[model samples]
Target: MKFRSSLCLRRTAAALAALSIAGSAFAFADDDARRAILDLRETVKAIQADLSVSKNAQMQLMTEINRLKEQNRHLTGQVEELYNALEMEKRSTRDLFGSLDSRVEAFEPQTVVINGESVTVDPKEKQAFDEAVLHLQDRQYKQAENGFKRFAAEWPKSPYRPDALFWWGTAAFALEHYKTVISTQNQLLREYPKNPRAADAMLLVGSAQAASGNLKAARATFQKVQKTYPDSEAAVTAKARLASLGK
Candidate 1:
C-alpha cells in the first residue's frame, strides 16, 4: 500500500508539470496575438492620418485651380478691351492722315488746260490768271487792261502770255485806246507767230488801225491776214472787212 501511494504521488506530480507547461504556452500565444492586433491597429491609424492629409491637399489643389481659372477669365477680358482700343487708335490715325493728304493735295501743283494746251501751274498762278479772265468777261475794260498788263509783266514766261496780250489789246480797243490796242496786238503777233490766237491778233490790229482812221494800213493788214492764215476765221472776217472798205 505504501508503494501504491508513492506511485500515485509521482503520477500526480508529472500531470501537474504537464499542465503548467501547457498553461505557459497558451499565455505566450495570447500575448503574441495581442501584440499583433496592436501593430495592425497602429498601421490602420497611420493610414487614416495619411488619408486625411491627402484629402486636405486635394481640397487645396481644387481651390488653387478655381483661383487660376478666375484670374484667366479676368485677363481675357482685359486683353479684348486692349485690342479694341488699339483698333480705334489705328482708325483714328488713318482718318487723320487722310485729312492731311487732302489738304496737301489742294496746295500742290496741278496740270490744267489753258488755251487748248496742257500746262502745269501752281495753284496761285492759275488763280491769278483766272481772276484776270473774269475781269475781262465782266466787261470791266479798265480793270481788264490793267490785270492783263500786270500778268504779262509778272509772268513773262507763262504759257498764257500770248492769250493775255490778245485780251489786253481787246480791253484797250473797247475803251477806244487805239494806240494801246495797236501796240499790244502788234507785240502778240511778233512774239507768238504760230500761236493759236495769231490770226486773231493780226485782225484786231487791223481793226484798231481802221478805227484810228488809218484805212490804208488797215486794208494792208487785212490783206496780209488773208494771205498768212487763209483757212482761219480771222481770214474770213478779213475778207468781209475788205469788201466793206471797197476792193
Candidate 2:
C-alpha cells in the first residue's frame, strides 16, 4: 500500500508539470500570432499607398498624352491649310497666262482683257505684276500678297487697279485670311464701281464674309450683288447660298 501511494503521487506531479509546460507554450504562440497580424496590417497599408501613387501617375500620363494629341491635330490642320493655299496659287498662275509672270522692276501695270481693249503697260510694272501672279501660281501666298500690294501702290490710278485688288483679295482668301478679303473687295466695289470685275469681286467678298462666320455681313454683300449685278455669275451663286442658309 505504501509503494502504490508513492507511485500515484509521482504520476500526479508529472501531470501537473506537463500542464504548466503546455500553458507556457500556449502564451508564446498567442504573442507570435499577434505580431503576425500586426505585420500583415502594416503590409496592407503600404500596398494601398503604393496603389494610390501608381493610379495618380497613370492619370497624369494620360492627360499629357491627350494634350499632345490635340497639339498635333492643330499642327496638322495648319500644314493642310498651307498645302491647299499652294495648290490654289498654282491654279491662279495657270489661269492668268499660259506663260509665267516675270520679276523685273518697272513692270507696266495694264489690263489683259479677253474682251476689252488692251492698254500700254509700263514694262517694269507689267513684269512685277506678272511675277506676283507667278507667286500665286507657286502657292507662295505671302509673297504674292506683297507683290500685289506693291503693284497697287505703284499704279493706284491704273485701269487694272480693280484687277490687282481682286487678285490680292483672292490670295488672302486662299490663306484663310478672310478679313483682308472683305477689306480689299469693298475697296473694289467703292473705288472701281464701273470695273468689269467689280460684280465678281462683290460676290467673292460676300463668300469670304460667309466663310468667316459673319452671316449678316455676307447676306448684306450678297444683297448688293443681287441688286447691282443680277445677271452676273456672282449674283447667281449668292442667290444659291442665300437659299441654302435655312437648310
Candidate 3:
C-alpha cells in the first residue's frame, strides 16, 4: 500500500507540470500578438504623417501658382495702359507736326486767279489786299480807306493798284468827301488811262463834281466820258447823268 500511494503522488506532480508548461506557452503567444499589433499601429502613424506633409506641400504650391497668376494679370493691365498712352502720344505728335507744316505752307506764295488772270502773288500782298476788301465788304468805310491807302503805298507796282485807287475814291464818296473823291478819281484817270477802271473813274469824277456843285464842269466831264468810251458801261451812266442834267 505504501508503494502504491507514492506512485499516485508522482503521477499528480507530472500532471501539474504539464498544465504550467501549457499556460506559459499561451502567455508567450499572447505577448507576440500584442507586439505585432503595436508595430502595425506605428507603421500606420508614419504613413499618415507623410500623407499630411504631401497635402500641405500641394496646398502651398497651389497658392504660389495662384499668386503668380494674379501678378501676371496685374502686369498685363499695366502694359496695356502704357501701350494706349503711347499710341495717343504718337497721334498727338503727328497732329502737331501737321499743323506746323500747314502754318509754314501758308507763308509761301500761291497761284490765284484774279480778274480772269492767273497770277502768283506774295503772301503778304495777298493778305493785305484781302483784308482791305474784307473791310470794304463789311462797310467799315474808314478802315477800308486806310487799308487801301496802305496797300497803295506798300505795293505800288502791284496789279491791284488800279482797283485799289478806284475803291479808295468810292470809299471817299461814301463818306461824302466830295473833293477827295474828285481828286482820287482824277488821279486814277490820269495815271491809268488805258486801264478798264479809267471810264469808271471818269464817271465817278463827274458825279463828284456834280455833288460839289460844279454842274458845268460835271456836264463837260460826262460828255468827255461818253465821247471817249462810248461802248463802255460808264458811258451809259454818263448818258443818264447828262440827260438828268438836261432835265
Candidate 4:
C-alpha cells in the first residue's frame, strides 16, 4: 500500500508540471501577438502623417499657381489697354491731318501784305505758303526748315510769322538740332506771348530742355505751362511727366 501511494503522488506531480509548461507557452504567444499589433498601429500612423504632408504640399503649390496666374492676367490686361490707347491715338492723328488737308485745299487764298503796298505777282503768297506746307507733308525737314525760315525772314511782321516760327522749331526738332529748336520755340514764346503758337512753343521748349539734359530748365518751362497756359495741352502733358518724375 505504501509503494502504490508513492507512485500515485509521483504521477500527480508530473501532471502539474505539464499544465504549468502549457500555461507558459500560451503567455508567450499572447505577448508576440500584442507586439505585432502595436507595430502595425505604428506603421499606419506614419503612413497617415506622410499622406497629410503630401496633401499640404499639393495645396500650397496650387495656391501659388493661382496667384501667379492672376498676376499674369493683370499684366496682360494692362498691355492690352496700352495697345488700345496707342491705336486710338494713331486714328485721331490721322483724322486730324486728313481734315486739315481738306480744309487747306478748299480755302486756298491770295496774297496779303503787312507793311508794303500791293505788288503784281503771278502766284500769291499763299502759293509760297502751300509749297512750304508740301515740303513739311513730304517729311523734307531740312527743306521745310529753310522754306519757313525764309518766309519768316522775308515777312518779319506778317500774320503768318508765328506759324512759320512754330514750324521751324518742329522741323529742327525732327532734325535733332535741339539748340535751334529751343531758340525758335523760345522766340515764339517770348516775342508773341498772346499768339496761339505760344502755348505750343512752351511745350517745345520743355521738350528741348529735357532732351538736352537740363531737367531744372525743363521743370521751369513745364511750371510756366501750369501757371500761364493751365488749360493747354502742354500743361496736361507736363502734369503727367512731372508726376512720373516724383516732382
> Among these predicted structures, which one has the highest lDDT?
1
Estimate every model's Cα lDDT from 0 to 1. 0.93, 0.85, 0.90, 0.83
**How do the residues 1-247 of candidate 3 rate in per-residue lDDT, one tens digit apiece?**
9999999999999999998999999999999999999988999899999999999999999999999999999999999999999999999999999999878868887788766778887788888988989998899999988888899899988878888888888888888888878887888888889888999999999999998889999999999999999999999999999999889
| lDDT (Cα, tens digit) per residue for candidate 1, span 118-213 | 998777677777888999999999999999999989888888889899999999999999999999989998899999999999999999999999
C-alpha lDDT of candidate 4 relative to the true structure: 0.83
What's model 2's overall lDDT?
0.85
| Top TM-score model | 3
Give one digit per residue, the lDDT tens place, for model 2 in 173-245.
9989998898898899899887888898998898898898888888888888999998888889889988775
Ranking by TM-score: 3, 1, 2, 4
* Candidate 3 vs candidate 4, lDDT winner: 3
Estimate TM-scores for all models.
0.59, 0.53, 0.62, 0.50
RMSD of 2: 23.7
In order of lDDT, best first, we have 1, 3, 2, 4
Could you tell me the TM-score of candidate 3?
Answer: 0.62
> How much does candidate 1 score in TM-score?
0.59
TM match of model 2 to true structure: 0.53
How displaced is residue 165 in candidate 2, in Å? 0.3
For each candidate in turn, give its C-alpha RMSD to the true structure in angstroms.
10.7, 23.7, 7.9, 21.7
Give residue 180's error in model 3 in angstroms.
2.1
